[model samples]
Target: MKDMITHIYKGLECFLLECSAALVRRRALGGWRSDPRQLREQRRDEFRARKVAE
Candidate 1:
């Protein structure tokens, strides 16, 4: 009984992790992109410039 509960808990943890990662990916991508060209353009626009030390 205890082993079964532990297995179930581990499965739940995996499920939660998968869902969270999917959400994070969606947020990072700024939502879904149906068109390939537009998606590329959108991604390009999301880039940021950083300062470099000389």
Candidate 2:
């Protein structure tokens, strides 16, 4: 019974670690594309202004 409990506890620990790692990876990826929409809008405005100047 003690062995079974230990196994379950270990499994839970592994699961928690995996979840934390995934959360960290997700946060890192989120930072990469954080302002994509805003950046796209800014780029479009700049492009339009450049065309007007030309």
Candidate 3:
């Protein structure tokens, strides 16, 4: 019983840590972009595409 409780506790701790990491990453990027540079390039491309489309 104690062992089972310890295992569950450890699992919860790991899940919490993963959740924290995801939150940090989301806050850091401000969205779902994987990298800051990638996000910038994506925006630039999008602007160019819009200009071309018009």
Candidate 4:
């Protein structure tokens, strides 16, 4: 029926939109931890842990 076809079309359109949005979010956040400040902090933490273990 036409109603069923319309429902299916809407569902596919929503799914495609969600997929594209997720791809955009992935690209945007892919380098989230590459910030120099965060890297430095992580290194500092590791160094402190090593010092504590020794």
Q: Pick the candidate with the highest lDDT.
A: 3
Clashes per model (N, Cα, C within 3 A): 0, 0, 0, 0
| Best prediction by TM-score | 1
In model 2, the clashing pairs are none
lDDT of 1 by residue, 1-54 (tens): 999999899778766865665566566767764455765564444332111211
Ten-residue segment with the worst summed lDDT in candidate 2? 17-26
C-alpha displacement of 9 in model 1, angstroms? 0.2
C-alpha lDDT of candidate 3 relative to the true structure? 0.69
lDDT of each: 0.59, 0.65, 0.69, 0.64
Regions of model 2 farther than 4 Å from truth: 31-54
Q: Which residue ranges in model 3 land beyond 4 Å of their true spot? A: 32-54
Clashes of 2: 0
- Ten-residue segment with the worst summed lDDT in candidate 3? 42-51
Cα error of candidate 3 at position 16, Å: 0.6
Per-residue lDDT for 42 in model 3? 57
